[model samples]
Target: MPTTLRRSLLAVLATAFLGAAPSMAMAGVNPPTVDDNLDPGSSIHVTKTVSTPVIPPRPDVVLVVDSTGSMGPAIANVQSQLSTIVSSVKAAQADAQFAVADYKDVSDGASVFTVRSDLTGDPAAAQAAINAISAGGGGDGPEAQLNALWQIGAGGNRISFRPGSSRVVVWFGDASGHDPSLGHTLADAVTSLQGVSAKVVAINVAGGDGLNATGQATAVTSATGGQFFPSVAAGNLSQAILEGLTNLPVTVTAETACDPGLSVSFSLSLPRTVQSGSDLVLEETISVAPDARQGSTLTCTTRFKLNGADAGDEFVQRVAIGVNDVTPPTVACGPGVNPSGRTPGGWQQAGFFQMVADDNLAGVSVAIRDDATGTSFGPYAPGTYFKLTQAPGRSGSTAVPFTGAVDWHFGFRGDATLVATDAAGNTASATCSVPPAQK
Candidate 1:
């Protein structure tokens, strides 16, 4: 089977499972004590929420191509298609910036070569660089992919977008150079690149049997939330790159109410207008009052209207709703001293952290992470908080306790973010930071 066909099948299977599953219940699970749910207060008492489509920000791209003796034909093909790729990307997103890096053997070693430092919106420069590359190097040593990835991740001259732009590193190679042990080095480089919100896309040009190619692409892409195109050739490389650039769906959860018969509606706001061929999936939950029907069918439809045109904007999707009999859980957190400064024992000593996320239909789970180390902590134990009588006056709050004499010397150097996920995998996160202790 073709690689694209396999991916398509997998996606279809996943979607089929999601649709066939029973409508998730939001009640019975305990509500958090602090009412920390990020969405506006819920009245229908939905247990879970999840999103179907997620569009990411504009990306900065770095094109890394292999320039080996055997790659003469492939290299030439890539050079010819360079203009088309740039134009397509620009058409999709105007802010996209690009850079080129070609690797060939220099006097010092095989992997060493020249890198153009300037990044631009100009397609001419990219094309020029592509045309200038020569594929004649003696040492057939594997391409220095690890080193190149590291350099790109470290924000070398190849990637030059301003801060905050999404960064994407696209690596193209024809043969296996280094062993999988280089994965650690690749991962570290990717990690640094991610610090700037950049991801790595590996496109292996190795044809014939795709044994090592697939594995290499997977290693790099998995580490950076990017994609791997194994066995891709110069002919299909541009398309592969574009497909990889498209953002995947993001999960979102909102709280709203609906009567047994009345249709409840919600709208998804996009960061920008949706492109013509692009489509979005709308995932939702309609929770009924406690004494409502158990096996009712809830209908859902997605409408895309321009300027409030009812005719053009309406598209419908439906699902069967199932009732959950279990009682909702309650959530709670800290009665102890708040960590004013960095706790001497790091995050482990933050005390018993707890929160209750309840849904009359679906229920919820919460996760916490330390922003400084990018370390994730937990789905803290439940039942330490109180349920809202009628949607508490405020959102939610959670407390982290600091024990012993506060070490003013090592104050909080980073942020701790808390995220709550419902049964539907809908999530909301809140960030709190301990101020740096006085010197």
Candidate 2:
């Protein structure tokens, strides 16, 4: 299974389970503390989504032909259709170029290594150079393959490659290389290739009857983040090369959310985008608010775009996080027993909204507010003096405590506000008024 698919599954499962089971109920919502089966509070959800796209790149191809005694058939096939390959690539990238390099054995004299033609955008020139190469003069099972790569890679870009272009070296061969015994070692080739940011895709067609096809080509390809085809024929080589050149990578560019309580961090090791033919894991971490309600989902989104892709070519990921909320209590007001005229204070009942508002209870806060002393529960605005006092209530009943003073009087036609607040910042308010004195 792909890593992306697995991550997606986990995210879906989390949402699925939350909707199905009561085990994921809001945290800290104790049922015994409220009047009726009540709910916690509202919470936020964050979701993220990822996107992938394929964008082709301008190609710089160095067709490394294995010009040895055993590679005549493949070389001829390549040389014959060389112009067609250039024509195909030019359709995608007008600036695409084709270069030529032929490799022989160390014993093949000065003809052992030759760059018949450097990089050129002209199809006719590339075909002529391929036609000029003739296969022969190779001894032993292994040839100077690494030496050929080292020479071409170490050479200046003017003669070998184009600067500011994607580098590719397609090495077609029948047998393995003579390790590092030639002019340069495999390590030297790797260094040169890395320095030029080039990849060598090796196609080995030599492991026939008696030839012990060594894996030097495959190793070098892997080292340079390229690919190896064990027995790819010459006819299919053009398609393979084209596919590798055009493959693309997309990456996360930005993320934003409405809630100020969430924080996100991207992976440090993995590149934001997936590389062609490579398995990459996109990682990120999102932290929830300290007072986030349990079982609440926090959603976040991420936007992605391909490297130099076409305009409006982008993708997105929606990520969801669940949490719990801290809920507040509920309160109500009633008439006071104080004598009329002088002053009158009201009695207010308060209950914690743990499970159900009125029935369940543990601790509930009640605020007695005048027109001036504005309460946080938002029943009254600030303007007057205030004090906290416990109200009469059935101990261990649904109601917890209420704030008020018997001496806190309201003049005739006077009014006060009863404010109720719970742990999770939830609030409720009630108005208590005194009738005019025999108006």
Candidate 3:
């Protein structure tokens, strides 16, 4: 058979074997037989007991509703679903807290009324307040969505909660309330709600308006790192709100621990992936919990493979690891300056050198030098300014090389060194020449 056909058949056979392996294993093991005959009233009844895991407290939630006349249907629907909403919240978080805010006539003296304070672990009160909210007024002018959003997000009326508690803010509106025409941005509103780190969800209910309320809602949601539910009607409003609130935020923490010195081995557990690149991506936060050390140097040496073969010969990249408090080492290189030869009278010789270095904590430093006679030439900082001199070499005596094409037995040296001393004092060094200035 052809190579492609053979490979496909092998893959199919492997998949089939894998799919059947579990059933085959189970069939090989016989289950325990049960006794058919049992005593009647004389035998005691054995009950099967199950233990329930303790449920943690739920996150804090703030509901921002638009009470404009257009929201009557939505408000009524939300109130009707109050019981189910409260029950779902309670089921998910035994100690969840909830707050409600309503915005009316938002443009002119936009009214923001807080119907309830944070009702912690009190689902009954939250439901009562939800039932009490009435949608009225505020239909002619624009909805003061920016002001309402700002108040809930960063405004003084924002809800407060303990660390690790999820903070959620749901905004219900229709039509772009803020003035998108005059660049009345949501940035101010987004900036205001920074402290609580609240996730803002905007549910736009405006119908037949070309104002792009959905787009505006999405912008506000993305700004606060929240989700957007657009053009949802009153009937589906409660369900959408619950869906957005029920999602638990994924928390991640990263740590690194490894063997002490050269050839060090370390593992990291971050609450989430720290970096992503073309070759490899972090699947999840590396968790080194008990095994990994904190505030220590972790040297990671990953091997790249292509088709199960080492591809390190193709390309190699370095990844640096450092802790919060300590300052990491820096890399520095020597300059590449050309040496001076005899120039005819009234002629001057100019040489150029370049160096490169980098550091995670302390920064970088570079120095240039001439290798011919062990003498120090220059330690100029490496940058675009380090270019070859425009002057020609005395009309023919090896014409002082133009631009970057200068020759004079040069060596580029660099070292990874820092001011702060680390536990392992890990460092790196490299050296290379300018490849003999092209003939």
Best by lDDT: 2
Backbone clash tally (model 2): 54
By TM-score rank, best first, the candidates go 2, 3, 1
lDDT of 3 by residue, 1-439 (tens): 2345334433432333224211111000011111121111111121211111111124567788877767788888788775566555555344567787777654435244454555355767777777767767765656666666666655555556555555678788665665531232467667766556776767776462512443667676666667776578777777677656533232223222334321222222222311111112232111222333434444433332221222222222223333332333444333443334322232212223334444443433443332332234333333312322221222211112233333332222321111222233433333333232335
List residue ranges in candidate 2 displaced over 4 A: 1-56, 92-94, 155-164, 207-212, 234-236, 239-269, 272-439
**How far out, in Å, is residue 269 in model 2?**
5.9
- Evaluated against the true structure, the overall lDDT of model 1 is 0.48
What tens digits encode model 2's per-residue C-alpha lDDT throughout 136-233? 98888778777888876763243455555667788877776777746577788777777776777777663442112555766677777677767666
Model 3: lowest-lDDT 10 consecutive positions: 21-30
Looking at model 2, residue 121 earns an lDDT score of 89
> What TM-score would each prediction reach against the true structure?
0.45, 0.48, 0.45
Q: Which portions of model 1 show Cα errors greater than 4 Å?
A: 1-56, 105-111, 155-158, 179-184, 207-214, 247-439
RMSD (Cα, Å) of model 3: 26.0
Which 10-residue span in candidate 2 carries the lowest summed lDDT?
A: 25-34
Across residues 1-439, which tens digit of lDDT does each residue of candidate 1 receive? 2346435533432333224311211111111111111122122323322212111334467787767676777777767666766665665455667888866533327346456634677889878877877776626455555556655665343456566455677777776545422243555655656555556677777652331443655776776667777677666666566556553322122232333542434334322233222333332334334454432433333332311212111122232344433333433332222334332343324332324345444556765554554556456433332111111232333334334332111122254555666554556565544433358
Candidate 3 residue spans exceeding 4 A from truth = 1-57, 107-110, 113-115, 139-141, 180-185, 206-214, 247-249, 254-269, 273-439
lDDT against the true structure, per candidate, is 0.48, 0.53, 0.45
- lDDT of candidate model 3 versus the reference: 0.45
